[model samples]
Target: MARSGIQYADVQQAIDALLTRGDAPSVQRIREVLGTGSFTTISEHFRHWRNEREQNRDVPPPKGVPEAVATLATDMWRQAQEVANEGLVHYREEANRKVEAAQDEVLQATREAGDAAQRECALAEHLHHREERMEALGAQLADSQAQQSALLARCNNAEQDSAAWAKDVGRLKTRLEQQTSEHAQQRETERGLFGQQLGEEQQRNEATEGKLLALLDSVRQERADDDKAQRKRTQQLQARLESASEEGRESRRELKAAEETQAQWQRRYEQAENEARAQHETVLQHRREAEALHERLLRAERTLDAEREQRIQEADWQVSLSQRLDALQQQVATLPATAPENDDDKPAEDHSDSPPKT
Candidate 1:
């Protein structure tokens, strides 16, 4: 960088000022006099000024001046210029020493600045490496967090499934309990109905027996009177007696059929009782099955297809039972009422074979 604005005229003016003050003009002195100019600018201008002064110095003295006087004045002026030159030399030495010291300071400052720059560069590189490491760590942390979030979501889903499974188990258990209680009640009701029907049948059979016996005795008495009172009516009396015997035989057969029906009913009652006991055992088995179901709930999802088929089969079986019950009821409804002896013609419908569908 060079200082600007210093012209030849400015340098020349400064040099003349120095001469008027009786000081030797040098580049440093002219620069000092001007107070603001570059050494190169002042030196170039001073060179030109010295060339002009040299050319003018060889010119003759003024027209009025004598040769001897002018020569003495020139000697004296040369001697004074020599003295000023000596002082300029001393000033230049001092200026050189100060300039050297300034240069040393500039060199020292440059070295310190270079050291600071090196330290700053090293720090910037270290910071860059640190930032890269931080970025890598942050990426790893993000991956870990994503994995953890996935695991947590899976855990939450598993927890929800477990809760629903537990609720289903409790619900099934409650339903089983209710069904068991109802089955027991149904069994007892059927038992009581069967017992009542059995008693009623027995009573009806006994009453029919007594009425047949009385009719037989009355016929016997009429036959004796007919035979004893009139010989003419003997054939008719014999026919009437034969008819009474046939009626007794028919009545006896009906009584035997009634007894057979009673025995059949008794057997059915026992069978019903057995079936009820079996049903109770089935309930216990169902309890065991429920326990097994609870133990195997984890397998529930796997068995869904198979269980769907099972449920379909069970539904069909229930439908069949319903149809059978309906048919049996219609049969009973269509059966005609008969004499007390033949009252047991309608067979007691046994429905204890199959448990009721839930």
Candidate 2:
């Protein structure tokens, strides 16, 4: 019972028995008769049984009925025939027994009548009672025949019901097998679809992971290139700054040297100016001495003429002294101008060492 839940075969047998008794099987009554069954399980199978019955209900009974139903019907008819024959035998035996009893009474009456003529009237009365008894036995035999006919009709109806039920059970078994095959086919199709979808999703995830790694490498390369460019630009700017700083220091040194040289030239100009003034004073004194000497010569010439022959040798000495004085005056005039010209020539030599302009 546990291995097999209530099946259509169980329900079919139960329906056949109920149908033979002319009672319709219901869910509640089938459970009660089986003694161990789920109401829902019984109800389901019962529905299937009813469907089969409806399909075959209108069909006519077949001539070649199953052997089991035919055998059962044949046995019932044979039993009815045997019972009727036995009843007929009992009726004939009872009639014969009554007829023998009446004959024995008639024999006794004939013997008694011969013994006495006065007893003949009593014998006639006994014959009338025997006729009444015969009529009662005949009525009982007619009732027995009527009961045998009714039994034959019930047996015929039972055979028809059993044949109809067998056809219904056969149709239900075929339908159940078809439904089971279709359900198995549908399950296989759904399983295949699920596996295909899972494989596609896995492939998509792998492709996405590869793309993410490529994007990361590209970003790192761009960052390295930017850093290299920044360092190169910084190096160029540093070089330019150092070059400009060296040029600035050199310019400062040149400016200091130029300022020192200008101060030295200014001192030299003051000293040259003082020497020119002193030279001018010395030239004036020399001119005065020459003028005094010229006047004395003129006095000397006049005296010579008075005593020419008295001092001829002294006159020749005075002429020589005048010639030497004129030559000394010419030398003093040229020397003073030429000294300042020599002082101007010294600055040109010093200027050559000074730095060029910025």
TM-score for each predicted model, relative to the true structure: 0.38, 0.22
Poorly placed runs, candidate 1 (over 4 Å)? 1-49, 52-75, 183-358
User: Global lDDT of each model?
Assistant: 0.55, 0.48
**Worst 10-residue lDDT window, candidate 1:** 338-347
Cα lDDT of model 2 by residue, 180-260, tens digit: 344445444544544454455446446644654666567666756645754574465456456545645554565455445
lDDT of 1 by residue, 280-300 (tens): 565556555555544544354
Name the top lDDT candidate.
1
- CA RMSD of each candidate after superposition: 46.5, 98.5
Count of backbone collisions in candidate 1: 0
